[model samples]
Target: MEWHQPPAALVRTMNVVLRGVLPSPLGRGVGEFMLLAFTGRRTGQRYRVPVTAHRVAGDLCALTPAGWRLNFRGGADVDVTLAGRTTPMRGVLVEDRAEVARIYLDRMTELGMRRAARMIGLKFPLGRLPALDEVAELARREHFGVVRLSVRT
Candidate 1:
């Protein structure tokens, strides 16, 4: 699968919009997005970004193919802001492709096809989740995996 490289301007615009919107009262209505604030293990610089929140077996998780997700590779503490509230949490990156795909499938079904498609940046019909094989194939090809977060307090 080809990686989707959105234009730099578009990415900057989205970052600005998400930062503004996700912290506002209006954010409560957008349950799918959360602001994750973590210090870069290497840079010692704080980074914050909006990510789609996925629920896997009652726990909050996020699947990403981005290099930034590597900051959680060895399990890191993060501040997750969801629905206009911030909480400390531990984020662990799970790289097992099959497991990630299974969680992705579950999340897709749980979130419904439309929302899942929007999060995945794909367009598909609204009734059914992506097939397991299809999801696994994409997950493998795209290096997609999950970062499951546990609340700290």
Candidate 2:
């Protein structure tokens, strides 16, 4: 898929809005959105991006089509702010397409067919989720990455 970069102004606006809202109760009610804080691998500067996160078997999972996930390629620690609370977590970049597919499929299944359909811009039969193999094939074609985070209690 061709990547289209958003305008810098739009990105600036989103960063401002997310920074202001993410720490509020309103942001917590806005579904699985979370603020991911990680250090840039090259610059050693902190960066925060808003991502949709899922709780899978006691771990936080995020699927991204962006390059920001590459920051964790060196197994760096991160901070995730969800529901107005921040926690330290260790992040792993799952490069195996099959494993990424499995986790992505599970998250889509938990989101249910209708919502998942809207998310991927596909139409699906009611109550039916895509098969794991199908997801794997799509992931391979689309180059999706999975970031699995374990919260340090």
Candidate 3:
């Protein structure tokens, strides 16, 4: 499917959410999640995509499909807003595929398969989690991207 480019205004709104409202409510429901604002390098438009957040080692990280979409995989930087603070995060793009796998496994389990799967954008009514190894493989190859945002204290 062709990628959808979010308008400039939407990007601004997302910036407000990620950099302004996500940190304090760190582990809340995904709905409370403000979309991780990303931009299309070629189109220069903004896209607001809601993503699960994790504050690890004092920095916040955002995850996306490895090979599933364009708005993120094709983008270079990510913007996260939390608690009224906005920060333009440069993309580090996890280079270690294994690390990606491990991280995804942790995230999925943290969210809970039957409960948080839907929130994370996974649709599996069967309520079964793919084998951990299988999930890792998909995470490694399936258009995934990770952008780490630094918290401005």
Candidate 4:
């Protein structure tokens, strides 16, 4: 399916809602939610966006079909609010297709075999999951952007 950006107003609303709840005790149980704060490329102003983050190999990763990843073309300092705690982190854009595929597959696997497969545009036998190599190929072909964030100790 073709990806369409959500309306800006809706995105802003989401950010507001997520920010209000994510730091609360109730929001602490939402494992996948996080607040990613970074500077806008052109405006040089700070912007925070809510994302569904996946932990991979001790790093936080987010897959966005949106252009926000462009702000970290090389790497950017960021603050991530996760589970009611905010920490300093370095956000790196993973441009290598192979690495992107690996991360994507890892996240999908975490999300659930069947759901992840379907989200990645894969159709397989009802009970079977695609191999990692297949997922990598599909991810490379589709050009998904992966933003990997490492905590700055």
| Candidate number of the best TM-score | 1
Residue lDDT tens for model 4, 75-131: 898898888888899998988878877777676666675655434334454455556
Q: Which stretches of candidate 2 lie over 4 Å from their true place?
A: 1-15, 118-128
Worst 10 residues of 2 by lDDT: 118-127
lDDT per residue (tens digit) for residues 1-153 in model 3? 111235669756765665444545652333345445667666887765555566544656666663323444423666665443446765455656777666666666777775445434554544566666876666655555555555333
Q: Residue-pair clashes per candidate, as listed? A: 0, 0, 23, 0
lDDT of each: 0.81, 0.75, 0.55, 0.74
Which residue runs of candidate 3 sit more than 4 Å off their true CA positions? Answer: 1-31, 37-49, 56-58, 66-78, 123-128
Q: Which regions in candidate 4 have their CA more than 4 angstroms from the true location?
A: 1-13, 114-128, 131-142
Weakest 10 consecutive residues of candidate 4 by summed lDDT: 117-126
Who wins the lDDT comparison?
Answer: 1
What TM-score does prediction 2 earn?
0.78
lDDT of 1 by residue, 8-112 (tens): 899789888988888889888878899999999999999998888877788898778888889999899999989988889999999688898888777777767
How large is the C-alpha RMSD of every model relative to the true structure? 2.8, 3.9, 7.2, 3.8
Residue 113's lDDT in candidate 1: 63
